[model samples]
Structures are given as structure tokens and as C-alpha cells.
Target: MTRGPGRWAVLSAFTVLAVVMLLPFVIVALNAVKSPAEYSSGGPLSLPHGLYLDGIVQFWQRVNFGQKLLNSLMISAAVAVLATLLSVLNAYALGIGRVRGRLWILVLFLLANTLPQEALVYPLYYIAKQVGLYDSRLAVVIIFTVIQAAFGTYLLSAVLGDFPKAIMEAAAIDGASRWRILWRVVVPISRPTLTVLMIFFFIWTWNEFFLPLVFLISNDTQTVPVALGVLQGDKMMDATMSSASSLLGIIPAVAFFLIFQRTLTRGVTVGAVK
Candidate 1:
């Protein structure tokens, strides 16, 4: 089969759109290698005359970038794991289990997802203080896990609900317990959905800023986003260093997407079939 002229025209349009979208990132990467003086003199879009590593080095040392990166990775990983696990259980129960009022329960979870973090931050702050979890990485992890799980449950419920009931019935007839069937049968078939959920959880948790700023008050506990926010507020801000830090901050997320790109593409249409 060969594409017609119309298909080729559409492909060309999309190619142009992709380059337009990537322009900002290209500019940022170019500036990341320039010195602050060069950034100011040569303009943001100008290519660096030579590779200058001083900006990156200065940013890393000034902000304790290693510690911040570790903190972000740990918190994001914890949230992703916890959220994915809970979402799986919640989706199984609400989507597949013959439970009463499951639709209402799902509606409640959807509503919770709609509520902005700003609206709940004050109450959460008070609760964290009362529970002695404030200023701890565990606090951030727990908060993000719960928040991300709400959306994950909603997204995964559709996939789980669409699963074939005949297979579950067959497993049940074979004397497999519900727990065993879920772990052995449903889980294996739902790998694509789980992978998608894990990727979303990791990316969202890594990039979250507000909740971390509120819950992780201590410098040592602060994640990358909050640390970057603080860096921007310093009296003497360096444009090139800031650009370098921004680039470094996004590397983990970009790498994660690249690693799971195939899984993500496959998962998109996973539940469309039986």
C-alpha cells in the first residue's frame, strides 16, 4: 500500500508543526552551553561560539543539584509505585468487582481529581503538621501518591472494565481465588495499562511543585521543582545557569518517556479490542 498525495501533504504539515514545537527546546539547549555574558550579549536564540561548561558547573554546585536530583527521584519513584499499586487495586474493585454503588464511588474519585491543589493545600498543610509529617519526603510521597491515584483510578477503570468477563469466569470455575485470579490473570493481561499508569505517575510526581513546596519545607527534603523555584528567587540570578538547571531538571522525565515510548504507544489502543 502506498500513501496518496493527501497523506503526504498531511505528513508534511505535521513535520513542520513538530519542528515549530521543538524550537523552544532547541533554543534552551543552545543557551545552556553559553556563559551568562554570552547569553546577554549574543541573545537567547544565538548559538554559542564555543562550549562553555562553567554555567552548568556553577549551577550544580550553587544549588546542590545532586542532592536535589536524588530527592526528586526518590519522591517521584515512591509516589509512582504507591500510586500505581493503589490504582490497580482500585480499578479492579470498582471496574471489575460486582460491588454496589461503584459508579458513585468512581464519580467521587473524578470529583476529587477536579479539585485543584491550591484549594486543598491549607487543609493538607494543617493535617500534615498535626500528623508530624511536614517537612518530610514521606509527606510529599504520601500526598502525591494519593493525588495521582485519584486520576489513575479514573483512567485505568475504563481499561479494567473493558476486560473480557469470560476469562475471569473461566478462572473462577477452575477454583482460582479472587486474589489469585487478579494477580495471575488480570495483571498479566493489563500490563500495558499498568505501564502507562506508571509512566504518567512518574512524570507528574517528578514535575509537581506546589505540594512539595508546602509539605517539604526543609531544604534537604525539597524536590527539584521547589529547589529550582528557590534558585530563581536568589538575588543574583544567572540566565545561562538557570537555563542549564532547567535542562538538567527535564532530563529525567525525557529519559523516562524515551525508555517507555514503545509501551506507551502500544498501550494507547490496548483496550479497544476484546
Candidate 2:
């Protein structure tokens, strides 16, 4: 990790890894605009003969892509926010408050996080059906909020456990209640970590497939991943159109990551010049 001859090896490794990750995107982008005839003849690795818009346009319209975008954005944003808040609250109680048997409580959250979604599918489906939330985005939102929050609590609790007791004592002496101190002091100090958590939660929820597939069977409630699956399975789809679908599916998540990427770097570099 330190600067040395080893750094060159690390850089070379990352360069190769980056190329591998980016290769699919490049292929998809090129093929998204390739005519079916060209794609059939030359395949995905080939350069496009011309700019073909029809397949991309048709795929977009066929999938009702705008709705899928909205659903994915809404669900991911909701889960990210709700999960972060829940994690903060749980962490605050366990770490800062030091509630009795807090070790067991943290363990409980860790186990909840480690538990596979497969194990909960049937119960979630049944409960949602019983409560009339099945096939609803709200149900998915609720499920992921709890699921993501469990890990967040596990992580943030440890971070807060190392928080400066001196600062907390100073705040208390200045007449700050625990509630006020949490929002005004604790949350502010923890913003970078919380932001990182939010970014991961948003992206993770955005890319979720299986649970979304199982629960969001209705076209009206489906997210981008679900829509991509639907697009792939459609009998009328062509190779070029499938590529266009993949390209479309990738753009939003990539855009989100790139935009927040600045925030991530900023968080890490904030104190470097100080």
C-alpha cells in the first residue's frame, strides 16, 4: 500500500481490472446502435456499421422504460435513506447509549445481515400477501430497509463506539440533551461514513434482482433489473435490441456512481491539507 516498487504492480493490476470491468460496457455501447443485420453478421465484438436508432427506440418504448427508471430510483432512494436512518438510530442506542447487553444486540443485527434473502422470501411473500402489500413497491421498500439497515447498524455501531467521549462530555456540559447532541454533534461528525453507507445502499438496492423479480411480478411495479430480464425474455427482441436494453439498464447506475464518486473522494481528502 505504501509507495514502493510494489506500487507499480498494484497499479498494473488495477489497470487490468479496470479494463476487464469496462470491456462489457464498451461492447454494449457499440452494439446498442448496431443494426440487427450487422450484429448478426459481425456479433457484439464488432464495430457498428451505422448508427441504428430503431432498436434502441423500440426497446425503450416496449419496456416503458421511463416507468422502470422511476420505480428503481424511488425504491433505491427510499431504501438508502430509510436504511441509513434506521442504522443510525440502532447504532446510536447500542454504541453511544451503551444499552445493557448491547453486544448481543449487535450480534443480532450481524446475523440478520448475514441471513440470506432466500430464507426470507417465503415469509416475506406470505406476510405481504396477507397484509395486501404483495406486488407493491412499498413492500419491497420495507423489506430492503430492514435488510440493509441490519448491516449498517453493525458497521456504524463500531464506528461510534470509538467516537471521542471528550467531545460528547463537552456537549453534555453545554446543556445539550442526547437527542440534540445526536443530530447536532454525532451525525455531523459521522456524515462521511453515513454518506458512504448511503451510496452503497442505493446502488445495492438498485441492482437487486431476485427479490424484486419474485415480489414485483407486475409490469407496473418492476425496476430496471426486472425490466432488463423482461426485455431479454421477450420473443420479439433482437440481438441489437438486447444490447440496447443492457446499455439502457446500465446508464443510470453508472451515472449515480460517477456523481457520488466525487463525494467519496472529497470525504477521504478533507483533512489532507490541514
Candidate 3:
């Protein structure tokens, strides 16, 4: 089909929006590799005179960046796996099986999703402290898993709703139990949507700052963002080195999104249609 003027206009507008959103990162990146003198004298939009590794080296050493990176990856991966499994099970039961008071159950999940983060923070802190989970990696992992699970359930349910009933009925006729149908049928057909959710949850948990800050007090257990925040809060962080560290912090997240860009688009669009 020939492209229309309206479609072209919309595309141009979207391109502009994307650039605007990306502008900060672009500026930070330029500043990261620039010397302190250049960072201060040169405009953020200016091109760098040369690449410098000092900022990155100093940032890495001071923050123990390698350890923080692993901490973030472990927490995020655990959350994604646990959240996906629990959400898929909940969604399958709700979407495919007959149950009593399903509407109320869904209403409760929606309510849980809407609860304010600020309101829950103190109570969550208390609970974690009581359980001796404060300042631990598992604490943040558990919190991320639970918080993301509500929205995950909602998104998975939407995807499952679009599934045809005939396939499930045939599976039941063949003596397939609910567990078999869920594992052998529902999951296989829902790969795209699952990929989308997994990526979304991973990114969200990986980038999470407040929960990590509240739960992780020890330097050893800190995730990337919390560790970066510590670095950024230091009096010396106003230098170009701080900007470099900030750039480093954003690199993994950007790479993850790029890798999953296709699945994310499909998953989001599919969920939206229902």
C-alpha cells in the first residue's frame, strides 16, 4: 500500500517524541567521556574533544560496580522468573477454569495494583525488619516479585483471554489435566506475550531504586541503582566522574530494551487489543 500523508505526519511526530525522550541520555553520554574542564565549560549538547577513561575507571572502583551489577542481575532475574510463573498459573486458572467468586478475586488484584507505593513503604520496611530480611538481597527480590506479580497477572490474563476454547476442550477430552493443559498448551501458545512480560518485569525490577534503597542498607547487598545513588550523593559526584557513572548505570537497561524490542512491542500491542 502507498503511504498516506496522515501516516507520514504521525511517524514524524513519533520520531520527534523519541528523540526528545532520549535527549538526556545522549547529553549524559557526551559528558561522561569528556574531561572535567570540558564538562563544565562545554555545553551538554557540545561534542567532546576526546574520550577519557578516568571517569569510568574511578566510578567503577569507588562503587564496586562489578558487585553491584551482579546484585541487580540476580534480583531482577529471580523476580522475573518467580513473577512469571505465579502470574501464568493465576491467569490460567482465572481464564480457563470455572471458579467461585472470581470477580471479587480479580477486584482484589486490581486494588492491590492501585495501592500507592508510598503508603506501603513503611509497612513493608517494618515487615522486612521483623523477619530479619532487611539489608538482604532476598528482601529486595521478594519485594520486586510481589509488586510486579499483580500487574503481571493482569497482563497474562488478558493474553490468555484471547486463547480459543476449542484447543483446551480437546486437550481435556484426551485426559489432559489442568496442569498439563497449562504447561503443554497455554504456555506454548503464549510465548510472545510471556517474552514481553518477562522483559518488562526484568527491566522494571532491575531499574528499581526505592525498594532497594529501603531494603538494602549494606554496601555488599546494594543493587546498581542504589549503589549509583550512593555515588551520586557523594560530595565529589558533581564532577564529570559522576556523569560517567550515571551513564554506566543506564547502559544495561538500554541494552536489555534493545534486545527485546520486538517482543515488547508485540506483547504490549497484543495485551492492549483485549
Candidate 4:
């Protein structure tokens, strides 16, 4: 009986917290549908007279948001795929292979992750310029892939390190090559971790601003975040249009999360249990 009441109390507290956190999003969504005049004159918290698409349409045209969105999607997808693949291979080698100095290598990866992007950005810019990748989408993709791979390697290595070794021995006895065992056995079993890594990579790369802003100098090459910054800076777009653009910018990430919510939840729970 006491446990029941305690559980209810905790749930009630969490419910209130959720509502509080969601209040900003609720406010944004409401204001996004409002007309510019309404947004300027009426209170931000007030409801719109009616649902309107004018703000969204005007924002789309004013900022050339469609091209920016496409750029972000491409860069994010490429980074996620490349980073996840590299992480899986590196983790397998370091964790499951029991490589010499494996601990040292992981420590190096941890150190790499700890290094702030700001510290490396200038050096990276010089390198990209020399390599002829400066101001290119490929430049951002490559940079993020490497950066995200460090963290991904750390996570997947931890999970893979604890994986059952007996399975590896059994597969070896069946005359399986290392690559065969890794691809056929290990990867299949590590889908949850991979899924989690992919989701994180996608979200991080999609939301990235600094690198893209620095590297993507051309207007057409800029990603959504960079474009949004430009849109906010433009005097022509008032509050309503800015709000609409922001709403549009977040839709893809939110939709992606909702679509993969089950996989994400499973991955997190599995990681927790392990």
C-alpha cells in the first residue's frame, strides 16, 4: 500500500516536469501558426485566431530553407553511416579481438573525445584548405564522422567488451574466419548499440552549427542550422517567420526520433541492463 502511494507521487512529479519542459514547444507551435500581425500585436502565449500557413510559406521562400534542409539531411546521413560503420569495426578490433594495448587505445579515444571542437577547428580548417576540401559539404561530413566515431568507438567497445567470448570460440571451432565471425555473429547481436549510435550521430550532425558555419561559406552549401542563423539575422523576417522556420527546422529530427522511438528505447534499455 505504501509502495503504491510512493509510485503515484513519483509519477505525478514526473508528469509536472514533463509539462513544464514541453511548455516552450507548445508555445512555439502555437505562435508558429499565427499571422505576423497577430504575433506582433497579440501576446505570445495567446492562441492564434485560426491555423495559418502563410508564415511557413513566407519563411520557406525568404530563406531558401529547402536547399538548406537537403544539405543537412545529406551531411547528417553520410556522417551517421560512416561514423557508425567505423565505430563498429574499431570496437570489434579493440574489444573483441583483445588487441595489444587495447586499454591504451581506448584511453586515447577518450582523450580525443575530451578535446573541444573549438580547440581543433582552426587546425582542421587549415588541413581542409590544404586538402582542397574547404568550403565543401564533404569537409563537414569527414570532420563530424571522425569526431563522432571517437565517442561511438568508446560506447560500442564497452558493450562489445562484455559480450560472451564463448560464442567467438564456438565460431572459430566451426572454421569461421575473423571477418566472417565479426560480420555474421557479432554485428547481428549488436544491432541495438548500432541503432543507438546511428540516432545520436544523426541528431548531432543535423544540429551542428559551428563547423558548418565556418566551413560551408557558400550560401547554397549551408546546412539548416546555419541557414536558420542567417534567417534570424535577416531584418525582413519578423518573429512569426522566425518561429515558423524554427518549427520547420526541428520537424525532421522530431519525426526521425518518433519513427525510431521503439528501437531507441530498446537500445537504451539493453545498454542499461548490460
Please report the candidate that would top lDDT against the real structure. Answer: 2
lDDT of 4 by residue, 38-73 (tens): 887887888899998899998888768889989999
Candidate number with the higher TM-score (1 or 2): 1
Q: What shift in Å separates residue 119 of candidate 1 from its native position after superposition? A: 1.0
| lDDT tens digits, residue span 1-274, model 2 | 4688788889999999999999989999999999989988997799887899998899889889999999999999999999999999999999999999999998898889878889999999999999999999999999999999999999989989988999999999999999998999999988888898899999999999999999999989999999998667778898889988999999999899899998877766642332
Q: Which stretches of candidate 1 lie over 4 Å from their true place?
A: 1-3
Error (Å) of candidate 1 at residue 240 is 0.9
Residues 44-68 of candidate 1: C-alpha lDDT, one tens digit per residue: 9888999988888988888788999
**Which window of 10 residues has the lowest lDDT sum in candidate 3?**
94-103
Local accuracy of candidate 3 as per-residue lDDT tens digits, 1-274: 9999999999999999999999999888888888887877876777899998799998898888999999999999999999998899888877667467767777788899899878889999999989988889988888878888888887667668768999999999999998999999999878778888888899989988887888898888999999888776688775678778889899999898898888888877866674
Q: How many residue pairs clash in each candidate?
A: 0, 0, 0, 0
Q: lDDT of each model, Cα atoms only? A: 0.88, 0.92, 0.85, 0.91
Q: What is the lDDT of residue 187 in candidate 4?
A: 92
TM-scores for all predictions = 0.95, 0.94, 0.92, 0.96
Which pairs of residues clash in candidate 3, taking residues 3 or more apart in a chain or in different chains?
A: none
Instruction: Give the better candidate number (1 or 3) by lDDT.
Output: 1
User: Which parts of model 4 are misplaced by more than 4 Å?
Assistant: 1-3
Clashing pairs in 2: none
Q: Rank the candidates by TM-score, best first.
A: 4, 1, 2, 3
